[model samples]
Target: MTNLLDMRNLVAGYGYGPDIIHDFNLQIKKSEVKCIIGPNGAGKSTVLKAITGVLKPRSGAVEFEGKDIAGKEAYQIMRQGICFLPQERAIFPNMTVAENLKMGTYSLQDKRLAEERIHHAIETFPVLGERLHQLSGTLSGGQQQQLVYARAFAIQPKLMLIDEPSLGLAPALVEQTFQHIANIASSGIAVILVEQNAFRGLEAADYGVVMDLGKLVFEKPANEVLQDQRIRELYLGKAAKQ
Candidate 1:
């Protein structure tokens, strides 16, 4: 697989406070999922912020498809075939599902192509089709989350930066969300996922990375990381095995 993104020696922080992400490095290949896990304030989300242009990196390079995009604006990054969806509510509550989905195609220059992508996204997530005319906020939590992904899918991005996608969902919904996320990655787009459910996140990912205090502590195949006894004890609880 070819490397779609390469974030090397990333050192980022807020204002002049201090560097929260220190010499961090990450790479993702097409059609792969990389999950980042750690305790609260471990700077997992910070890494995504730096990559997505939400926070400028103090040093190092954020190379995507071979070009450096470290200091680019968020919109510029989006136009570069990278989509960042944060953990917070991403949908327009007052807009109908169809309207919100259509809004996703605003970046497309061709109306016909945008329409085609919207239709394709609806096919991928049928719930969006069912709730097309309904206000997005009227849908259930799981349904709203599905819509968020559906909108991203409409753009057909080369890489997606997703943060805490299953943050406040029920157990069953969380499982379903990860399933959809895995499906997206399998469909050929690389994904950088920041998830609170460490075990489930790693289970759904191709690569697993453990971050502590803004630095990577472990990097390995997802299954291998899951199998490590110390890692299992420290981050993923023993119950993760079952």
Candidate 2:
């Protein structure tokens, strides 16, 4: 089967700066979750930015559904069924939960379909439903994260580009965040996750990708990655090698 998303030979960086991603290549099947883990400055997040058009690739192709999407505007790429959740919390603090969800469907032209999706999101995350009228800023951090995920869910994107989903959460909330990612993947949406917590990220993913110095070090099935001695020693620490 054709891959859901294919990025080949991607080179990108901010304007006038040296490239941070070098000949990066990645591919994911529909509904598969690929987690990228590496030390700081490894360009993991740069790959997402290139694919999502936040930083246009200086070279190579980003293909989704067999069409090249390289250099398209972020909104254009999003409208074509890709949702990007940055490392920071994306919820609008001033908006009510219901209003936040409504914004998720902003790209959809069909009002009825948007409403249906909103209903589906609420059903999938009943907590969001219960908090619909509450101001998002007043919600707890975990609840606010839930609102972020719910909004992403409402969009029903074919692919989700998630950058550091567990970046700034209490340890207890971290597991809950990964569960949300798993839930999204289970619903048949491909996910490209860049996470700081390597072990947890790989556990939630079908595949584990390791990168360093702006290049891919290796890619492997998540289980194999978790078991590989070199990977364990390098990324997961000496304890993981036991």
Candidate 3:
């Protein structure tokens, strides 16, 4: 239950733009699944960006394992034991799955070490074992999501920043993705998921956070948030209780 991610009074934004995320704070524990839910423009993705070093924090801190990586570049942060598999397609569509896995470890110094990590990743995803030579673009949306996940795991990251992982998938595929995410947490890597599907996201996460307009609104156990009528009505709307 050691804290893995710590953002205290975090304020971040694009260059010269207004702070889309300010006074943000959250903590994640080792091997835990934490989900963040909020309406659009709530800075959910921005939090991920800042944590993964895609955006710099104008003030405050983004610490992982007590190391501040606020101004580090994206690749530098990856070397710091954090990897971000963004909501967008993170793989090269034209590349084979094997190639994508290789691309993931571009920062590593040893090929054999990278391959060893990739072997472990295949253990968690047997379907990928058979599809090593397959082109990423040819895979289904769910499979593509899995491929991106495998690529992220190829380097053995300590924490994963997943943004809207279920975006643009079929219902069954979304379910599959969420299940995979749960499996990921069991593998002992802490995961922070930014998802728009609040209900499903909370169902897969151990902890839940509700953000509103760039501010922290509610912080509670996933089940508590799931069962709370007022919270569901406020953030999830009419379909929440269903």
Candidate 4:
């Protein structure tokens, strides 16, 4: 299958800082979900930043749909059908849920198409419809996450770069957040998920990518990664051996 996004030998860092990602490589096919898991400061989130143009790579290629997008602006990348959800909840806190959804379509040139997508997003997450007039910050954490997903859906992005979907969430909300990711992939959107919770993240992914100290460790089918004894011991901890 043709890859939707491909990164080769990416070396990226922020503002004269030492390189956070070194010679990183990755590829995702259309409609595939790939979860990136590693310890803190392993450059997992930095990979997402490089791909989404939040950090420009010092060398190497970031090819999306056959175009090199290494140094492109974030908005430019978004316009080319990539949506990025950072570690923080990306909603406009003071804005109404409806307004936040509208912001998702900012790059869309066709008004009618944008409205259609917004309607589709609401249908996909009915809770958003119910809270359309509510301030986004007032929603429960899970509800806020749903709004974020709804907004991304509204954009109809080909690829979604998600960093730490389960971060700072209640245990119950963590499960729900991964479910939202599954739903997104089911709709034919490719996703690169950087998650701290390896088990939960791998569970929702087609493939598992392991990283350490700014480099790729390995890539495997999710089930294999789950079952690999070394991965179990090193990343999943003692419970994984049981």
Candidate 5:
């Protein structure tokens, strides 16, 4: 159970503003799904930003695969076997599904390997395969998110930082989306998930982390954390206990 990604004493913020994520520490093992849960402005997404190089850490280390990647740029981080899917649907509206998948492999130098990955993505997500020539913008919200997931997987990253995959989706779509993510984790790529839907996130996660006001407040197995009365009451509201 070696750590794939480790953030130690991380302090990061936007621009000249004060630090939003303070002394953040996290370690994710290979093939594990670690879900981060908290209310809005809890710096949950900020942690992902620091790891993915959207914002640089003012101090501390971001170690991926035993190498310190603290100050690397976003592309540099991606080259190191990590890819990020932001909260937003990042697909190109004008591009076809097949073309969007091709865009995801821009970093890979091997044409054959990239093509292999594309085929694998299509196989894993058959919807994308069936609609390869369809305009990505014309797809439903859930389909677009699925496309984003498929595109991220096209690079065959060892670790994926996914921000709010369920955002703006209906309940059934949210369930489908999490199942897709769970399937990805089951295939051995470590995932650090920032989720607004606490219940489902915990349900799908192997490990659960709770953050508040720029720091971690709780950490445990996802099931244990979900059943904790204190956590249930504090973050998930009173109905969680019933």
Candidate 6:
């Protein structure tokens, strides 16, 4: 595949074998921030799951870095330099912020190497460094989300799959969260960001793909797609500018 990620002719769904995502095709370049946006129940999250191996595609290929990764296990994908950060709150409530980040690198065989990555992660997220000793459960909602992201980064995956990054945060916090995601991409990691903040998601993405009833309705450069009236109406449920 010419892309870092290529999902072609993919059809996947939850158990019933009825594909919620049918005939989907998407390709993301290396080190790019690609965001998927659509209305609720539009199968946006499912696409992330499929890419992360949380849900297997019934047919078609999910190629990553030239290998077909379809049907592989989640941890296997992680080992191959891809990590998925779910929209759900995933922090260890009782663990200190630093401890949670440490847990992420537990599987690495090299302790010193792991520490090196941890140092990098903390430096990238200084707020996390400040909260090193604080219990994760006690942090603010945005802080908790940041912790989850920090933990994921500790694994040092080449690809990061993010789902609904701004789902429940206040508007101000949401902006901060998206800003962090942008930085993650800028740091040379390929990010597949699935978000409900369509306008902001589109703005943050290097490329944008619109989903409608589980199908990819359109894919275009972020700026160009945002200006497409039909794409906006189909997924945003609003009339677009002329």
Off by over 4 Å in 2: 238-242
Q: Give the Å error, residue 158, model 2.
A: 0.7
- What CA root-mean-square deviation does each model show from the true structure? 1.4, 1.3, 1.6, 1.1, 1.3, 2.1
Tens digit of per-residue lDDT, candidate 1, span 1-242: 56799989999999979899899999998888899998899999999999989998999998999998999999899989998889897999999999999988988899999999999999999978988999999999888888988999997899998999888888898888888787788888889999888888998898899999989997999999888888888888756767
Better candidate number, 1 or 4, judged by lDDT: 4
Steric clashes per prediction: 0, 0, 0, 0, 0, 0
The C-alpha lDDT values of all candidates are 0.90, 0.92, 0.86, 0.92, 0.91, 0.86
Task: Summarize candidate 2's per-residue lDDT along 20-111 as a digit string, tens digits.
Answer: 99999999999899999988999999999899999889999999999999999999999889999998898999999999999999988899
lDDT of 5 by residue, 82-101 (tens): 98999888999999999999
Candidate 3: misplaced stretches above 4 Å? none
Per-residue lDDT of 1-242 in model 4, one digit per residue for the tens? Answer: 88899899999998989999889999999999999988889999989998888888899999999999999999999999999999988889999999999999998889999999999999999988998999999999889999998999999899999999998999998878888888899989999999888888899999999999999999999999999988988888755866
lDDT tens digits, residues 54-150, model 6?
Answer: 9988888999899989999988877788888898898899999989999889779999999998998898889889989999999998889888878
Write one digit per residue (lDDT tens) for candidate 3, span 1-242. 66788889999899999999879999988888889998899999999999888988898888889888887898888898898988788879999888888887888889789888888778777887899899989987777888887887787788988999888888888888888787778889899999988888898889999898899997999999888888788777766756
Error of 3 at 189 (Å): 0.8
- Model 4's alpha-carbon lDDT is 0.92
TM-score of each: 0.95, 0.96, 0.93, 0.97, 0.96, 0.92
Candidate 6 off by > 4 Å: 237-242
Q: Can you list the residue pairs that collide in candidate 6?
A: none
By TM-score, is 1 or 3 better? 1
Span of 10 residues, lowest total lDDT, candidate 1: 233-242
Residue 46 lDDT in model 6? 93
Lowest lDDT sum, 10 consecutive residues, model 2, at 233-242
Candidates, ranked, TM-score: 4, 2, 5, 1, 3, 6
Candidate with better TM-score, 4 vs 5 = 4
